[model samples]
Target: MSNDVFTPSRPAPGRTRFTTGPLPVLLASALWGTTGTAATYAPASAGALSIGAATMGFGGILLCLVAGRSALRVLRSAPVGLLLTGALSIAVYPLAFYSSMALAGVAVGTVVTLGSAPVFAAVVERVLDGVRLDGRWALAAAVTVGGGVLLITDGVQLGDAGGAVAGTLLGLLAGLSYAMYSWVAARILRGGRHGSRAVMGAMFGSAALVLLPVFAWTGGPLLSTGVGVAVTAYLAVVPMGLAYVLFGAGLRHTPVRVATTLSLLEPVVAALLGVFVVGERLGAMAWLGMAGIGIGLVLVLTRR
Candidate 1:
């Protein structure tokens, strides 16, 4: 786990945006999509909260270290409100996301969490940032969310009805938290005082502080099993640390809304992993739902 994976070569002056920008983000999302599948390999004793906390808490510190002095400077000089909200959202996202997967199963949980992010981003942009919504995005979101509904209704039941309900709610919260953090990152970038690495470092580093106690409490079981420890380490290093670096690079050329929507690949990857690796079943309706999401992503990605 070197941060070198996040470091894209400098593009030539005439290089396409795809090569220098969205590709990295898409790759990052693909890596993110593998998280729930990978978590399945962990020992059963590992709680979702602890997994989430460890992923962000430990990984965040590593990100901060890589970001170095500029990251610290940005943390010190950034507005208190922005920094606090970003950190808080970051802290909440992984907790809600991992728990959602545990209760709802990987496919449904990842679909709900990642699928809803674009909608949240759209709303945040409109209400807070005053960015206008284009018709393509609106239509694309409707189609994608419609697919999400199908996945939710058609998802394989995990625990009780209460667990499903709770997971879905938490998934929505995860989506909101994700959108909030993305907005914060974009805002920080707009300020031009900090680089993307610094912005991410600042946000997650503070979030790591918030999650450290939770990791300590719930992480005891993680150490009980060697598999759990290894999986946790993988999650922290690959998906959390390296993925965010690529994500930051991607955001350089992509708007938050488009970036989030592009990340819909996450759910598709998660679903594939759930079916292939985790032995989860996706019924016809769920397959159709996945199709809708795919179509929606294609529409959005192809739009001028």
Candidate 2:
């Protein structure tokens, strides 16, 4: 759950100028790659809000304890617009994600949703944020998307099934949520003068507030067994809680492409889990698709 995504540093004497800053940021996505697998066992008792609240709350504790009074000051100063942006963005993933999974299936929902985040981010940055994109970035994106398609088709079935349609829609929503979170987080980071921790903390607090009623009304989790509670706690702590902090912090320090590309490992792991852990079947064609996706993703990550 907790990843070393942000580490303050001074440049070494002979380090490449462009490659300065923390390595933790670049590593964050790889750390985040474990999310889906971990969340598989989360408590059915908890809804997205409760799960998200637990995660944000626990993660915020870490930042608060580390920053002390400064953290509180940052929270106080963060503008209402920025807070709403963070809360709304953060709210999207949990609410829509599980809904998609329930309506569709894991493969259809997760791939379409999470896979498209970077593409959306790239577009938003170019069109709205006024960031420039290079030719290689274009090629990299092409390969990346192609690879994702290969993986999704290979790993998941997407005929005219009712579930597939729902899942695909959910996946689309997931991508949109990812885009919103990235953009809003960027706003908070810049507007708060790098007070990202405080901004995130408040955002989580707001999300928790939104979900509190749901949590109370639900009368607890679907899981009554000990295993259920354990699963929920793990998901809350690791995937939802820890993963977001790593992701947010990494975004603060790393290239968007690097972080997003690395995050692709999530589906790869998911596919593997489907086969080995869950006893799901995959065909030879699917294996080839997985290979292509892995290769394409590697290219995207390794290319200059």
Q: Please, what's the RMSD in Å of model 2?
A: 4.6
lDDT of 2 by residue, 1-304 (tens): 2221233454344334223322343344444445455556666555554544444444445444544554455557667676676667666666577667656666656667666777777777778678887776666566656656766665454655886776677767777777776676665665435444555555665655554455455425624557656755565556655555556665564456445555666666677776887777887755665676666565654554
Best by TM-score: 1
Across 18-84, the per-residue lDDT of candidate 1 in tens digits comes to 7656788889988998887888788778899998999999999988888888788877888989999
Candidate 1 at 192: error in angstroms? 1.9
TM-scores of the candidates are 0.90, 0.78
Shift in Å, residue 2, candidate 1: 19
Report lDDT (CA) for all predictions: 0.83, 0.59
Positional deviation of residue 3's Cα in model 2 after best superposition, in angstroms? 15
Give candidate 2 regions above 4 Å deviation: 1-35, 38-71, 158-160, 190-192
